[model samples]
Target: MIPVGAYARVSEDKALRANAADWREIGEQVAEQFKDMDALAAELGVTITRRYNDNNRPAGDPHIVRNDFEALLVDLENGTVRGILFYHSDRLVRQEYDAARINRLFQLNPTYVGRAVAGGTDLSTQEGRSMLTIQATMGGMEVYSTRRRVARKNKGLAERGHIHGGPRPFGWAEDRRTLHDTEAEELRKAVLAIPGGLTVGEIRKQWIDLGYEPTRNKKKPGTQTLQHSTVETRLINPRICGYRTYLPQAERRDAKRPWMPDFVVRKDGKPVMGNWEAIVSPEEWQACVATIEERKRARVEGRAAHTTSAKYLLSGIARCGKCSFPLMSNQYSKGTASHERYGYRYACLTTLGGCGGVTRVGPPMEHMVEEAFLLEVRRSLGTVAGQVEINETKHDVRLARIDQEIAEVSERRRAKRISMSTALDLIEELEGERDELNRQRRQLVAAKVRRQNISPSLPEEWKGYSVSQRKIRLRESIRAVMVHPAGRGRRFDPSLIEVVWIEGGK
Candidate 1:
């Protein structure tokens, strides 16, 4: 009997359904195809020496590499098998290029045989080669037609604010519309924290400590560890702010694509709001986006410092009075009569390009800053609450008008009443106005939260805050601590340390 190789490939739709539990179904289908191939081979008086199966592998997409198909081609070239057999011609060759490659191989080896159980064509013959090419071309056309249909359906769904299928998002329930209370709250905190200088790593650590797990990985069922990238992605997702987002398949697959406002589907320059409840306000979400973009810019420009939570109160915030360089937290030893006493100090180390003119005991400086911070917080809290409400009201009115103008411009463009250039110019101006309003509104909301968190017992409450939290509050109140050189044997003079408060401070 003549020896031949049998090959089978699973359809792309079935491949998407493949999993550990569902593979048995795919395996049974593959087995039936192989059985048919064997029956055909026996009828042709050929022996099946080997079988090649590209299980759950796509054949139409040229970008997807099929290892088993390549191996079969190698065997044919090396004369390991005299011919090949497949269930169908399309299954064997889905592209004209692939069919041409196989045709050349047949020409090189005249004795080679190729047969398909479904088509009953002798692929080694001239007529059969033509048939294979036609089938492959038809297959490629079908793939493109299906893709276009799916894309249209998805676009319609996105415009209507329907939830297209995927793994359940972190803050939402399985239905994707209902909020998961605990997870949603965490998401809100994370969004609010980002604008306050909290890093993704810090947020991730907090989630882990609180026993919060991300959506379970379907492939790795037992794995529940939350990753930094996952946290950042969730925080930046427009879905949390009640907006639906859509991107082309190419952009979605591009790992290097940066998250931007353009990803959100907009009609007439207004975001297409989703059907679900928003976990964070749009202003707060925009604030998070702005903060993330700024961080990316800093990183690209090589100015971003290490994002690990700071251990010292004012390590990076304090600067040298003489050189204006940021001070580093260090340990300094003072010689005593019998032993050396070591203490934590913020110093202007010459090694770090500082003038080495300033050093201060950490405890004293921290205490002074803390007292001043609490005093400022108490004074500002009373005045900020009433002003924030008035500003928020004013912002809301202007923002509404801006949105109306943008919508009108878009409508005019759609109706062919305005040229594209004219519409774009009007929309750009309106968008800038809208952005500034949102930014101002975000600041008001953040101030309100800060005010609500502080009470008459702020000093007692401040003691409970973590170092990172304290640093955030300090930064909001004070711009920098400029430490001047102290004369030798000066008795810890408060005169040498000058605290430059942020604007609107005493």
Candidate 2:
């Protein structure tokens, strides 16, 4: 019912960033500030209706927008709020420009007033506004002065190859020059296993099973264990390869975070190197990064790439009619000269839940699907052959562009104008581009290969291709095979199955 606007703010410190418990300490301070303002509002016989807070955010950052403060000003302009309340005037506006804007608002609206509970400064007349301006200017000066001092200290610490008073990075000692032997070994093992065909999740399981501890969290006063996220961060950080990165702090925005871009530039336009010992070689680090990136792309594009490495006829392409879940293939074999080869049976993974109860023998089903696919391919090979050639030509052009981009980045690195970390980041980006281009090239070539094998001129050539090659051809020509439960009395019935064919793209 009362129309009073209240504001509060606090800046974050290094201790608050490093120690999770320190957040509670900072929260209590803001709470106490609100307590004093609430008392003042009650003394004046008005309830505080709208509250604004910018806790742990910089007040003097030029690019930082104080959303709540701006909203409070909007409310004051429209005469929605009769008065503004704060523990002190400094908390309301630290920057001189912000303080002047508040003065203009008060001048335009003579009836609009502000009250500072703890400070005795009144906000009703000319002398009060002058004092408020002086206090805000002093607060602004303190903020900028502190910013310069902190920047100088951090730059010095970085130049010396020591962490700038935060939690020590994983796999490194407190001094950050020497590797922590046990943790460093785990880091090496994890990074090495990535390129050796182990998924990040698998590596996490192995480390957790071995009771591997992460970097010590001295702020928590307890042992910390390795986590998947922390593992990923350690793998990509150039610091692991004895390189220091300097990311300038910037205002938060919706587009990208400050640290998202490579910011390892030096003041004199020269490369910056680190004095610390390297935990992993640059080649090992790059390989690990590439593996992680490829895995991420696989997850985004299709679940087919994420399936078990077992070469099944339709591991990802087969589905159950009832639950629509993929039918996983299980391998079985009997020891004998004629039966030693692995046999597969496709069954709905969720069959135990009674949703998809279908089970089909792999060999017979695969044979039936292949026969149908060959028939369709024979009828449409002429149309698909033309499109395949067009796609191949397009891929060749894109591959050339990717090669040019790689050369450009290499040239930039040779100029010696950017820091080593920046050059490495650019190189990684170019490598990813190159890898994607090469994958497209492979797809184009494989399309051409399959077109030749499945040509109308040589229809039986498809049968001679490897199982993996046949699987790829199957995916290109068919979308899914939905398997239904066999009819009541029979063990398996082919009439109940539905094959979904993929149309050729022109």
Candidate 3:
């Protein structure tokens, strides 16, 4: 018997299924196809020396490289196999380049046989080569036609706010229109709590402890785990606020890209309302988006969410008066009595680019700063009563104008009117301006919310605030806590702690 190779492939879209039973069915179909190819080889009196299977791989997509197919070509070129067998011609070649490669291989080895279970093609004959070429061309046309149909169907579904086929979205039931009660409630609380100082990391821990699994994990059991990026992506998705967003398959695969406003499906410059029930109001959702975006920007700039040795109120907020370095929270062991006594202090260590000249007892200095912060807050509450609204309006107008400019720049690039480098630079500059405006607007909105929630018992309320909350308030009200070095042997002095108030006390 002459030795030959068998090649088989199943595209990802055709093989993927939501349930185990459906996956088993796809597996059976693949196995049957291989079995038929084996029968064809037996009839042709050929022995199958190697079997190449490219499972869950697309033949037409240029981005998807079929490794097994490439390996089979190498074996054919090396004369390891005298011929190749497949289930069908279309399954073996769906793109013109792929067909060209196979033709070149056959031209170099004129005697090599190419056979399919459905039909046989002798590569040495001109008629057989023409038949294979026609089959490949027809297969490529079919792929294009199928893709166009799927795209049209998906667009129609998105416009109608219907869920197209995929893994079920979080906070929504399998039916897609109804809410998953527990997940929906958790999402709603997260949306509201984020703007009120809840961090994404905190929410991730909360969900993990509650035995919550990511939605995509259902498709492949025990494969995926919850991640911080997943949590942030879910939070920023407009679907929670009853808005449809249609992301192309390519963009969906580019998961590292930041969420942009362009993802939302729009009709006449407004988001298309989804058919599903909204878990949160649009305003609440927008607030969450702004807060998340600000946090992301802060992280990129290395300005917020410092992981310090301790969660001291002024760890990253206060600076050394001499070297202008941020003070870090530190603890030192004192003389031991029955046990060692620990003293907490904020210090400027030379190792951390500080002058090493400033040190202050944590409690006393923190107390003084707290008192001054409250006084500043109280003083500013009366003066900034209506200023936040006015500033927010101005920012909104500026943001809209920036967005328009960005859109125009993108259009010019698409039309080939601008060089790629110039378009990129323009877009980057506009995006930076837009992000800064967004940060300022979110700060104003947060301040407005804080002011509305502030009660007459300001000092009492200050006592109940968490360290993180206090840090946020301090950064808002005071530009920096300048800790100056005190004279040797001088008692703990509040006079050395100078609180520089922010512009207009906030």
Of the candidates shown, which would achieve the greatest TM-score relative to the real structure?
Answer: 1
| Residue-by-residue lDDT tens digits, candidate 2, 406-497 | 56777877897677788778778865775565445434543443355455653576655545446656776689999988854575577767
Question: Any idea how many clashes model 1 has?
Answer: 0
Worst 10 residues of 1 by lDDT: 333-342
TM-score of model 1 relative to the true fold?
0.81
Go through the candidates in order and give each one's C-alpha lDDT: 0.78, 0.67, 0.76
Model 1 Cα displacement at 213 (Å)? Answer: 4.6
2 or 3, which is superior by lDDT?
Answer: 3
Q: Report the number of the highest-lDDT candidate.
A: 1
Q: How many backbone clashes does every candidate have?
A: 0, 0, 0
Q: Estimate each model's TM-score.
A: 0.81, 0.46, 0.79
CA shift of 496, model 1, Å? 1.3
Q: What local lDDT does model 1 show for residue 290?
A: 63
Candidate 1 global lDDT: 0.78
